[model samples]
Target: MEQIWDNNDWLESANHWVTKQLKLQKINSIGRLKPVSGWGLGHVLKQPTEQGDVYFKATAKLPLFSNEALLSRYLHSINMPTPEVLAIEETHQYQLTKDFGGGLAEDSSATLWADAFEQFAQLQLDSLSYLKDFNKQGCLNRPISDVAAQLQLLIEHPQLQSLLDSEIILATEKAIAKLSHNIDELSQLEIGETLVHGDLHIENVAMSDDQCIFFDWSDACISHPFIDGTYLYRMPDSQDKTQIIDAYLKPWKQHYQPQQVEQAWQLCEHVCYAHQAISYASMMLHLSPEARVELNTAFQNALSASLRSNRQTVKSTTCVRSKFCGMVSGILHTLSLIQIKAGEAL
Candidate 1:
């Protein structure tokens, strides 16, 4: 199987397509198209134009990864600060967007992280009204109601079964049953579903003045917003994420009390891990054998974490509150931030 970047004919055609799009926008290409990154998952290339660098990205065709170009434009239409899309070729899953500078640095202050979390939470809350539009635009619809069935399907999938040991498979099955019970309890809370970033972290965000420009919508979906909180709280280099968690929950305060919110979070804790496992299972279908070998460990880890969370008892409200503070505070820490090179759409 030839990778997209390795195909000479495709590369030539892609270059011509990029040049034509730039010319239509009255921009001239001043330098050769440079490959910034490429992998089995996706590919990124930079086109140096008179205006500056414009990026070209092609996301692999996958069940969970949506058509990012279309989704990003829709998000921008809904007033989300996404990167400016210059051109798009839906058939090839290709997108061209203007550069938005580097994302948050490794040494960014806690205040910045808190602000981002709060702002993104507000965005998630606001996105509830657009749930129908999100669904229409091909965003994955993985509601709590469908999770158990999805897990069962994956468990029965021959490909996935081949990757897991007998013990872990048994644990996963038991965990899925437990997860169904927990989902029923969570549904009683009536927490509205909203847009989940699916893969939220500091690297996917770029700050412009007071506005937070969030890119990389490939993993975005319409689900419970707290699923994103799990990904955000686990961002590298943060020893204590209570402030981050509190900041994320700030926008939801008007809707629920701290205890209610914490309970909902605990109930959905294992759900997020299960969701990751499902995502990886979908990816396995599209990956080559070599790539699948690389992904096997991550897939197993997600399943293991899901089972691990299932065995733990929910913490008391008092302990949960103590572990999480109400206010966001300022502090500095060194995060291993990925530098946004040539439109870090990856």
Candidate 2:
């Protein structure tokens, strides 16, 4: 964690790596050292240009480095939104990416990210055939099970275990079970080969005017067709979410099985929930006092959301008769409608 070499020194070291991958000039003084997160080896630099603006990213030995680059190339070829990897290669102690920009960050608006979501959906249809070749659906999803194991580890961390009381842990476990059940449901859906973005999320998606760019191909692999909607399915609002999914599925289903598409949403949501839990643990295990409070607050919000959703799902499965009962029932039913709108099953 000590400074990964001085920023400028790191820049030069990175440029040599880039030169091996593609032709690019080394410029003096980075336009700005953008603060970014995830996999910590990467950094962004902007260089002002007469024609337009150019951005660069430097990394130290990315795991599966070439595979990520190849996937990025494939994605770009399909006209999906993604940073152009002008070049990439290894240097003395690091790897480098030239002009890598795009992908959302820690602080971004989910409401206004519709365009990004749409682009991702479009790309899913285009890329599904090839996605499965990169990673198998069953194995990529084992991480979902890992999430439960991670949560169980926290039984020793009193600060975290305290959150499990008051139906939180029980509810969490139930949802996870449903997730596993749904994952099995997907395997049985009879859907054919397709590529999937194993870890699509708001932060992994980015927007630029009418274009939406997806980055971070670390988890890019082959999966069941519908597994890509993991982020949009968990997002807020039924009305917009429905319109959004219809925008992607209604027409496309004529080509692929609608049920398969639907099953993808179900599997994606649970896997995504598991992924979030893992991400939370990764952040909290060594967070500062302030960061710890924020992490706990976030986990609580997700917990509350999950509980409210299950209650509504149960109410939707029951009968409704009276006006007052109907009213509460309608509200819960509305919340339960999230899965339906996002293209998941009841």
Candidate 3:
């Protein structure tokens, strides 16, 4: 197999690879192999075999490939709700696994979210003993220094200058500095480390009958388990956020005091916001000029909205400045971050 440089090449190579795999498996007919969107460094195609429907994922991102393969196997061994790895083409960084079909709908019920969170919490709790294994797989332990460094990169990025003025930039920096200080304090607190699905949004989860299967373990890491709750905070306002959080923490209560659980939850919420800001900033570095413009415009609009929301409570000049700084931080953290779509020209 040749190196896949872009989405077209990836699709072509993946089709050939899946076809060969189908033949080897003695599946005579193959269904339409459609590409799954929203992935940044991989090509995933849904494959229909005589046996059943499965998924083929191929990535040139070696770290992600290795992490997913190792972590999925570990999760499967523990009977977690993840797809079963059927085959691995290590030489080419491709893997075949059972497909769980389209994930929960965009408007999936609150009950579904609760169920997923419960299962995810259990997975996190059960995997604590295997932290050493996760470390061996090169999963990142997100220390305060690393998080701070990422924030610094985002602050220094050339692209940010185009979107924010000097005043806004300064305010944003102050807000980030405060966030960094908070993270430093949180880092000092003793917390359990476990397998965190670094990108556990609703889209990453799929439902098959009664089973909830999670895929896209590319961002899996050995970090504070609360990091996984970032997606829960991004859920639609219509859903009961309190109920979802309660369901997620219910399992942890078995081993932790209520106060400890709440503290971890609060720390994780802040970490999630900071992590998102850093991620978007990092992504900005790789994006094309056109994509950056789109993102910049979107970010500015969000920032403006946040500023309006802050004006009501901010009376004194000092309070206004503080609110402005927080507003900038919140805007960057909550921006509807985008990636170059799988098939779109980059």
Count the clashes in each prediction: 0, 7, 0
Q: Write the per-residue lDDT of candidate 3 for residues 1-346, one digit (tens) a residue.
A: 1234454565667677778877787775466677664334566778777788888776534332335655676677767788887766655557788766756775677788888888888888988877777766546566544665666566667877666777756655555555565566556656677788877867888887787788878667777788788667555555477788888999988778665576556555555655655544544455555445555654444333323322321233245446557877887766633333433546
Could you tell me every candidate's TM-score relative to the true structure?
Answer: 0.85, 0.59, 0.74
Let me know the TM-score candidate 3 reaches against the reference structure: 0.74
Give me the displacement of residue 215 in model 1, in angstroms.
Answer: 1.1
Q: lDDT (CA) for every model shown? A: 0.78, 0.51, 0.64
Please identify which of the two predictions, 2 or 3, would achieve the higher lDDT against the true structure.
Answer: 3
Look at candidate 1 and tell me the lDDT of residue 2. 39
* Candidate 2 stretches greater than 4 Å from native: 1-42, 49-52, 58-74, 77-81, 89-116, 132-167, 191-211, 216-227, 263-271, 282-300, 307-346
Q: Name the lDDT value of residue 173 in candidate 1.
A: 82
Q: Is candidate 1 or candidate 2 better by TM-score?
A: 1
Say which candidate scores most in lDDT.
1
Local accuracy of candidate 2 as per-residue lDDT tens digits, 41-129: 34555544433445445432322222454555555655656766554332322223334445667446444455565556667666655
Error of 2 at 154 (Å): 6.8
Ordering by lDDT: 1, 3, 2
Once fitted onto the true fold, the runs of candidate 1 whose alpha carbons sit more than 4 angstroms away are: 1-7, 105-107, 232-239, 313-346
Candidate 1 per-residue lDDT, tens place, 231-330, comes to: 6533454644667777888878777776678777777777788888888888886777877887889889888877876665244333554554432221
Which residue window of length 10 is worst by lDDT in model 1?
327-336
